[model samples]
Target: MQITPVTPDLAAKSLPVIADAFANAAHSDGHEADLVTALRHSSDYRPEYDAVAVNDEEAVLGHAMLSKAAVVADDGQRWPVYVLAPVAVTPAEQKKGLGTALVMYLETMAYGDGIRALSVLGDPAYYGRFGFVPARPFGITAPYEVADENFMVRELQEGGLTGVHGVLHYDPAFGLTPQA
Candidate 1:
């Protein structure tokens, strides 16, 4: 399968695939597809940060989006971050390495573009394979209450998070309210 950025045509075909991908996941909220659609239209959406894996017949097999996020320091500083959410692969394609390829591709794109860091709320075992480590140890907090181990972050380059620290917030489309 070939991984490519999501185009209008590819997007139209991938929505259902995305929903199907998460259908059986115990962690699914049943709105991942909607979340993706909302994210695509949100200000956080970046063409370079999203991609689709397609087959030889040009059918979309999986999808992922690395969209904009921020870490708000107590000093009122906002540091840029990218959040990897709702990575989806058709049930049939799961465990075939398509997800890994899509993630690596997006990471490569981010690193090439000089992004400093990225975050994701996922299983440690799954994301750790890509070098993700718990963010709490690094002073990064999620906007809402999530288990510390569930929210992870990774530096794209050496010293990427050197001076960055605080609460990481997702785009409004994620439907999460910051802790008051």
Candidate 2:
């Protein structure tokens, strides 16, 4: 499988792949596809961070996106961060590493873009293999109540999360009303 950036024309095609992949997931909240749609139109959206894993036939087998986010320190300081969400792979494509490949590829792009860290709400067992660890220890917290283990973060560089501590804030598209 080949991992490639999802260009504008390919964005629509990725929707179904994402929907289908999350449709039957035991832990899915059922709005992952919709979240992707909202994020696409949000001001923080970055097309380069949207990607897909394609098979020999060029069919989208998996998808992932990293978008703009922030961590607000108690002193009201804001530090930019990246949030990975809605990563999906068709059920048939699971266990073949397509999802992992897509995520790793996106990480390289984000790292190149100078992003300090990446965060995701996912199974620790699955994401840990990629070096993701609980964000709390790094002084980061999710906007909503989440299992500490499921909210993971990876520092793209040494000291990436250093001095960056606070409640995490995601894009408005995440369906959370921004605190005034």
Best by lDDT: 1
> How well is each residue in 16-126 modelled by candidate 1, as lDDT tens digits?
998899889999999998988888899657976779999999999999998788898989888888999889999987998999999999999999999989899999999
What is the TM-score of each predicted model, taking all chains together? Answer: 0.96, 0.95
Off by over 4 Å in 1: none
RMSD to the hidden true structure, all candidates = 1.6, 1.5
The 10-residue segment with the lowest total lDDT in model 2: 171-180
User: Among all windows of ten consecutive residues in candidate 1, which has the lowest summed lDDT?
Assistant: 171-180
